[model samples]
Target: MNLEWLKGIYVPILTPMKEDESVDFEKLRKQVNFIIDGGVHGILAHGSNSEFYMFEDDDYEEIFKVILEEVAGRVPVIMGIGAIRTSKCVKLAKLAERLGADAVAILQPMFLKPTDEELYYHFKTIADSVKELPTLLYNNPRIGYTLSSDLVERLARDVRNIVGIKDSSGDINQLLEFIRKTRDLKFKAFGGKDTLLYSSLNIGAVGGVCTTANIFPELVTSIYNTYVDGDLKESLELQFELNPVRMSMDKASFPVATKDMANINGMDVGKPIKPNHASPSGVVESMRKEMAKAGLLKG
Candidate 1:
């Protein structure tokens, strides 16, 4: 209910899987501690980086339960219940509410996706389903769907619970427009791409929903803290330092590359859920040098 905590680095925490690709709750616990101990503002469980689509039945609930229990109100936890099925997404949103998540972030249905009007109704239905839980519309164009600023403005204006959106597009103009359109509505806008964190802040974005923070929480949080403290020089320096890792991981298979960076940093994040999802050996090797260059290595 308290949205103020949204204004910092909220990690889209990875769902660590065992060798058979079953969810590794133990390692997941360690990851929660790593980020919490590392001092991130919040956690976003089951995000794309968390491999939400790879999940089977009950997989979503169990993983989310682990995260909710581990986080234990230490900070906010935003449950991601994105699905290609509209009804299924609503069910997951309700589940998040029942489980006491502070909020839920929804991904617009991907394949056979929706028209803009359908998208509006889809989000509206979910928001109406759980009026008490604040919803953040996720706009990641990489997925081949985007939540335009106009659509977001409409959601912010029409849905009381639809209080914000996360714009993954690295385009500053889109982010600025989202900011401008929702400025008077008290709606929150978050930068979804790690590379745009600093610029997002300068454009009046409250914070970042970043993938890189999964490994380097301190770096992401430092950017937010420094910028908020009026230290533009240090903030820009930190944001600049994070770019290589962001770009490097992006070249690989999402959270796989991200998880590999965690291992490079000495955290045992295990491998990604799918074997083919693994980053190429060369990519992993290159990530090591890049992670080190970004000063994200453990110890």
Candidate 2:
């Protein structure tokens, strides 16, 4: 498969929910248009930032359909499968293929730290199950174990459809090693952390699946656009401006800041799903001030 279309800023968009904690498809469609209009290059439905764990299989189908429909072929869509069971992951991967997604990103099985052999098989099984949809390995250490470069290389070499990885290890070196190790293969590397977008691209990542793009798509996409356009200084500067705000997410709870930023920006993405409430008012205000400092917020 020509994976050339895989390069650029991809948004792991927020799943806009209703006050009752159910997915509001209307808001989801609006969010899709919101990010695409903001200049993102691709869309990743069911990403970590999307609260994917809360939904059922039926939920996945509708979510995928809605996103693909809203996207309308404007940008490539990659459906993400982060389920823990190999069977479940395969089911979602097949679902993505059935829905006409351009690609599928499978997150390492969460909550269970499988051995290297088991891990390899887990990814291989899912990729093999799909006929031809490009599979991108998603390694988020927050799941408790990282996908070592060696493991990733082995999968890339052995699995015909495993074409890339989204390294959210937060360690730039880890991201670099994946790129370095896979350089000879058809594999593509994307930084999963928003703060490392410029550095990741500088070190040979094709692009990033940035959570911030859901809030500030133009800002995030500009980093990739400038870097690809040969403006290293501007791209680095843009990354610098994005880092503090992205880092400030730590002040709020996990994954809440992205939604907080969206709400404050007047996107009204609604509250995060239950058990994950809105960020404190002070936290949101502080985040707002940070965006203002970065010139992202005006009056």
TM-score for each candidate, following the candidate numbering: 0.96, 0.98
lDDT tens digits, residue span 1-299, model 1: 56777778899998777877788899999899989887798999988888888888588889989888988889899998678777888898899999998889988778766678889999999989999999999888877867778888999999999988888888899989999998998789899989999999999999999888888888889999999999999999998998987788767765578777777777767787764466778988888888777666667
Q: Can you tell me which runs of candidate 2 are displaced by over 4 Å?
A: none
Candidate 1 C-alpha error for residue 63, in Å? 0.8
Among these predictions, the greatest lDDT belongs to 2
Worst 10 residues of 2 by lDDT: 290-299
RMSD in Å for model 2: 1.0
Residue 157 in candidate 2 has what lDDT? Answer: 95
RMSD for each model, in Å, please? 1.4, 1.0
- Among residues 3 or more apart in sequence or in different chains, the pairs in candidate 2 whose N, CA or C atoms overlap within 3 Å are none
